[model samples]
Target: MSVIVLDKLTKDFKNGRGVFDVSISVKRGECYGFLGPNGAGKSTTMRHLMGFYQPQSGSATIDGLNCWRDQKQLQSKIGYLPGEIAFPVDMTGKNYIRMIAKMRGMKDLSYEKELEDFFEINPASELRRMSKGMKQKVGIILAFMHKPELLLLDEPSSGLDPLMQSKFIELMERFKKAGTTILLSSHMFEEVERTCDRIGIIKNGRMIQEINATELRHSRLKTFELECEEEADLNKLLVQFPKMLYDRQTRIVRISVPDSRINELIAALSVCRLRYLKEEKHTLEEYFMQFYGGKSNV
Candidate 1:
């Protein structure tokens, strides 16, 4: 079952910027990641999905409900965390959550204790005085406590520490097991690699690629460092593998080849009197750069 669908969705802002002809879908009980660099229209797409802005063309639907026409009904089933946080200065974390609960007409604060125990957040702290990480924890708890069917998280772990980030990942896993559909939008590739089943990469307001995490990992290039007793004429071998990248300096050679061609590369390199040889798989950052046309810096 597809919980969310974007059919050629296009949005243009007054300044002539926004996503263009985007089409993607998130299946029920699946976690999909929306990834892009800063200023790449990720937030614009999310805003349209949340009904903050209407599309210039095409359509977006959530659970068969038109996002723009059924805002109220759709919102009730979705939990959202914006990229930025701005809470009332006078309210404590507890009061803020209570207010949201009252507005949603949901009672039963039983989950409050569970959230506090897992996140180690003190609800008594004033919103203004809490640390950024603490504030983020509060937002996460609020989003999950209601048990909404769909979650829209924008850079959800921006302010969290490593420990809390791990815990949040665990929480997402639990939510997935419970059959919740999640759309995670973030610049953090590692988080997406860990939590999402599939990822869509947006570049300059256009989606460039959509691939599964497992497939991406398997398709990544493998890096190898080779040192020979004497300068080796590896050009002939390199030409055999079109995907391989090689650099040689002072009897030291560095080679990178797609994972699928590693066996051929290994057989070719075996003939040389190698002083040193090491092979390593590329990380998610490397895969993103290769697929999305960017520098390999995560």
Candidate 2:
């Protein structure tokens, strides 16, 4: 059975800004990446999934149960890490974790202690005095301590350093290997590409694209950048490759073509003397640009 499902889920706010008709599905042991710019309804959709907000229309389900109606049951089965956290202003991290554990009816905290050690979080300090990174670590440890079957992480790596981000990815990989289903939302392409099986791109509160991670990695489309020995060489190449991006002053031409047309591109470049010819590294950034609007970038 699909572990997570959103069927035409719609939530409209009073200001006419909200998610509309968004649908997605995630299977057991699969990691689904949810990506969108800031205020593009990413957080709104997550909130609905977590049963924090009731959907005005449509539905969200996890393990064949309604997210809103069966939230109590769902909460135990899933662990959620929100984009922003609200910690008690005066409570120390040690006390706060203890309080949560007590509320959760946890008698044995061996695993939770392991999480604290794993993340290098110092639970002795007060929450207000903790750095952003330390707080984020605390959040991550709390989310994973329960060892839930499904994870709903919204910008899980926010405020984390690059080394810690890499650790987060490794932790996720371990979870994946253990047959955990995850729905991770983030704007970081590298992190998403590294951990997710499929990526769903949202724009203006609607889904704009769904791409397979492996297919993206081995895509037929490739971009190349070339610097000609002379301006004439560049001009000659431009005539043959009309679709190319070129700068006359710099004598540089950039073009994207399918792998099958590499011979054609090579043929066109052969007639021109090239100063430097190299294939540009293609990242998910360019792939995401088509769906990313300028109004809000998150």
Q: Pick the candidate with the highest lDDT.
A: 2
Scored by Cα lDDT, where does model 2 land?
A: 0.87
Q: Over the stretch 1-298, how does candidate 2's per-residue lDDT look in tens digits?
A: 6999999999988575899999999999999999987887888988988999999999999989999999988888788899999999999988988887787778888988988877887788999999999999888877887888999999999999999999999899999999999999998888887889999988878887888987887775788998887988877776777889988888888988987788998888888888888998778877787677675323
Off by over 4 Å in 2: 220-280, 295-298
- Model 1: lDDT of residue 106: 82
Q: What's the lDDT for residue 68 in model 1? A: 90
lDDT of each: 0.83, 0.87
Task: Go through the candidates in order and give the C-alpha RMSD of each one to the true structure.
Answer: 4.9, 4.6
> Which residue pairs clash within candidate 1?
none
Worst ten in a row by lDDT for model 1: 289-298
lDDT of 1 at 83: 85
Highest TM-score against the true fold, candidate: 2
Lowest-lDDT window of 10 residues in candidate 2? 289-298
